[model samples]
Target chain A: MSGFCRLERDRSLATRVDGGGGVMTGALAPIALSLRGVTKRFGAIRALDGVDLEVPRGAVFGLVGPNGAGKTTTFGIACGYVRPDGGTVDLFGEGPFDPSKHRGRVAVLPQDAQLGRDIPLLDQLVYFARLQGLGKQEARSQAGWALELAGVTSRARARSRTLSHGMLKRVAIAQAFIGEAELVLLDEPTSGLDPVQAERIREHIVAQRHDRTVVVSSHNLNEIEAVCDHVAMIDHGRAVLAGTVAAITGKNEEVRITLAEGPVPLDMVKTALAGDSVDWDEASRTLVIRFVSRPGRGAEDVIGQALRTLLGHHARISQVVKGRSLERTYLESS
Target chain B: MIGPTPFRDMLLVAWFELKEMLRTRRALVVIALYLLGGLVASRVFVGVIGRLEDVAADMLQTTRTATPGALTRQVLHSDAYREALVRLFPNRNVADFLLGLPPIVLFFAWSSLAFVPFLIMMTAADTVTQEVQDRGIRFVVIRTGRVEFVLGKYLGQALLMSFVVLLTGFVYLAVAWRGLQGFEFWPTLDGILIFWPRIVVYGFAFVGLAGLCAMNARSAAVARALSFVGLTVSWVLGEMAYRWSDGIFGAAWTAIGFLVPFSHKAALWRPGVAGVLPECAVLVALGLVYLSVGLVMFRRKDL
Candidate 1:
């Protein structure tokens, strides 16, 4: 069991104590959620193959996958929405798929799910709160907090039918937070939103990242790029890439030297740096240099050599911009 | 914060359904129709009794000229008149005359019938269909378990349908109890106690029917139509078979009745002397079968 699963067990124990449902003391560790070698197959179609994932105590995780990549299947399995043909899931070191033990600690904003048209947004939140075992008044108060958490405090009283899709999305997010969940599963929290709404939702997830682990799946790579600290990309039920954002996207290094002079011809430089890569950007009058040397070779090594060559050509240098190395590696690898 | 228990989760799902039902105004309309239907049907029953009483009175007057006996007067008691007056309609042995009232009475019973399946559809319509449509189900890999989601959704729909069933059951019972001859209809405690339980049994049947239909379907429209068709077809088959072969199975007709919740409850109650089914055994069987199938399907589903 991972540390994430332990936390969920602790929360359940605490709840049982309060609910007078019999409490077990100090017997279980506090892990939020953990998965090991989970695999799912739909006849000939293998949706998730040998997938292992871990969500830490409090962090924002992003899942990026193309259509039919089993990202949703992974999500469903984690939340107990779907059963895996193989693998073990643990919530706070408790067995996976135990609705009786792990429900209050988990909240999910399912993709494209709309609330009942007749229910009020506030009522919907409160109802979810109640489901987490709060009394009516306590649930109502917590509902307000949930809406505020999702940044939709003003729309609490609005009828679900009257609200816009963006607002509805926010309500769904609010519901995810209603129980002060330790783990939040958000499926496309901002798919169809305008730029502003999308940003607001991203901000909400980020704000909550310090206390609650957020696992979000979205085709909107930009959203994941903006809010995720860790990311996993799936293609056809297998993980093509998985790691921290910096680790996955920062795999290679590139140094761009913007010069005050005209584009210095790199014919000789290209010939000399045979086995390496170099490109000159005319718009910025910058020469971008890329190589697969390694981490030990710093930007200073590339910069020093580039300058020496430029000086030999009597070229003037301006500012230098060294962007993400891993992004280049990811793109190339993919 | 409290951790979620199955009971709490069940309640949360039920609360959500109640809020949705109340907010939609459809619940209110259905309840109103039920009330109106119950009153009208009761009146029809009493009215038929009134006509029968008048006929009895005329017969007595005609017979008084020939045989001036006290037995006729004893049979025509004041309490009998009161029962007839209160009921406002005749209680006939024939099922058609009783069923001929407004859709409210005949239809409202099935209205809650509509709610259970519709609510189940509402809960699960988004299951695999919406996830595929929006490509959202992929996120579950990181935060929750797949089985948890399937079970959670199934439990949620079950909880919601149960609430609707109970509420509508109460409505049916309240109307039926009030419209009856105020305890005059059944003089024995066994009879009166059994009547309310029978109504409750009817409610359980609806819950099972709705849950099973909703679980089997992907769309709300399909769920509703399926439940409706299922109900009608089963009853038709049961009625035809029973008439043809003395209530024995006629080419799987009994199985058809099991498919239609209303028909099953009606048939179950057909053995009762007062047109009510003793539905304990049948209710338990239907509820368990439907709930189990629904849960199993939901757990295995992709969303």
Candidate 2:
């Protein structure tokens, strides 16, 4: 047992760092997972049609879609749980049909699986550990660590049926990290959780982004914006848009300057910041700027220069705000 | 990296099921009731014999001198006794009654066998429906292949059920052995001492049937109910078929009757009465086919 434990610990250390300990993969590797021309149908209803997406590794990816938009179906196909009627899901450059070969490579927090209600929470965690190929002793050890990470270690011996819904959700999320899979899939991890429990789950998820790839799904746009590095919005079974969160949100950043003392001429401000990239809203007493110099930089620099010009015009700025966040951009695009 | 196989995953699944079932008070309650029922029913049979002897003594003054065993033997030879025994132990021997016990005690095991199918349905329904209801099926499907997930659940639950059925059968067999000593209950009772094969067959049947029900049902309770209803209806239909054929279907209907495991045991008795074995080969073959179809259907299920 000692020798096996030492061996597993050594293996863990080796995987955690490469050579000089710099990330073996970049902070976010390009297109860790891809789904192309995916179509699925159940009898007459087409759940997904010509859907396309790419998720970068070592970053948080969010798949945001409404209840019947085929998001879960796509995720299931990716994990090899649901065979697709058409198209393909490629994970870590490997085809999804054969994803079972990547079993220990990814972990999933299924949407609503409470732990075994009849068994202790720790026992359920240990059961997951065994699924990841760990021996009994190793499984028990890993389950202990996982329970701590989930903040349910205190309830480890308690039967899962006795745990609150929030705790059960956390435990489900905790199982996703059990084997330290390179990629983790979390389906609605905080759906029924209280604010505090949701925050804890969010923090745990964010902390894992540095060490692994995560693909999460939720109906809440704010939660998606808060945790996801890349975002994919699906509506009515099609991928409306998908890219890095910054790339999508950065498309049209606007600097809004509100004057406290005097009403500044909107035309003058527009003229000063003028370029094909700039537009002004006179009704709101604001200057709308877009900096198109860089590929995704049409707005950032334009806003910066426009703010300076506003100060030059004695605009008596009351407030400056960065508008057109990803949420708004998504709403506009979709 | 060592990748896991469907078989290995199934072990983990079965192990969890075994743990969960063991902890569930419902399962414990069912098991306890079954054991309690068996013990009490057997003791009642033993007690009833003593009462019957007293009644016989009052009716016949000479019988007061006769031992309970002799009195019972004489009763068995009477025309009224033959008619009554025929109705009482329809599938058993009159020699069994002559040995001083009712046939219902020998076959009380049939009713208790419902627990196997019940547990199987409960386990299967909970497997996929629970995942869907909990919303975890979405993510779990991502880590493991659907085929592995479904097959793992099927095999795991089946293995656990096999253990349970075998354990219960052992207990029942022990009681039967103790109660049937010196009684010509049925010559085949000796051969039926080992029940592992029946457990395996019934386990697989229950697992497959329950898996199909789970795939069709959106909730755990619905799945279990459907499986139970399906079992009950099939057994009733099989019994009707048996009676309509004057039991002359030559084990064809009996083999079909095996679809409802316990019912098949009853239908198999007619062949035993004539000293010929019912064609269990067809029954086992049908069970395997049901299992195969279940596996295929589960592989394609949305969950």
What are the iRMS values of all candidates? 6.1, 5.7
Give candidate 1 regions above 4 Å deviation. A1-57, A86-95, A135-138, A258-321, A324-331, B1-4, B50-194, B232-282
Indicate the DockQ of the complex predicted as candidate 2: 0.34
Provide a comma-separated list of chain B TM-scores, one per candidate.
Answer: 0.54, 0.63
Native contacts present in candidate 1, fraction: 0.30
Whole-structure CA lDDT of model 2: 0.64
> Candidate 2, B189: how far from true, in Å?
13
- What TM-score is obtained by chain A of candidate 2? 0.84
lDDT by residue for model 2 over B109-176, one digit each (tens)? 34444455666665555666666666545544444455566666666666666665555555545554
True contacts kept of each: 0.30, 0.67
Poorest lDDT segment (10 consecutive residues) of candidate 2 chain B: B268-277
lDDT of 1 by residue, A197-271 (tens): 677677767877777789999877766867988887777677777777756654246677788865475875676
lDDT (0 to 1) per candidate: 0.58, 0.64
Residues B9-114 of candidate 1 have per-residue lDDT tens digits of: 5444444444555555655565455546445654554444445555676886743222221232344344674455347544343333333222223333444433
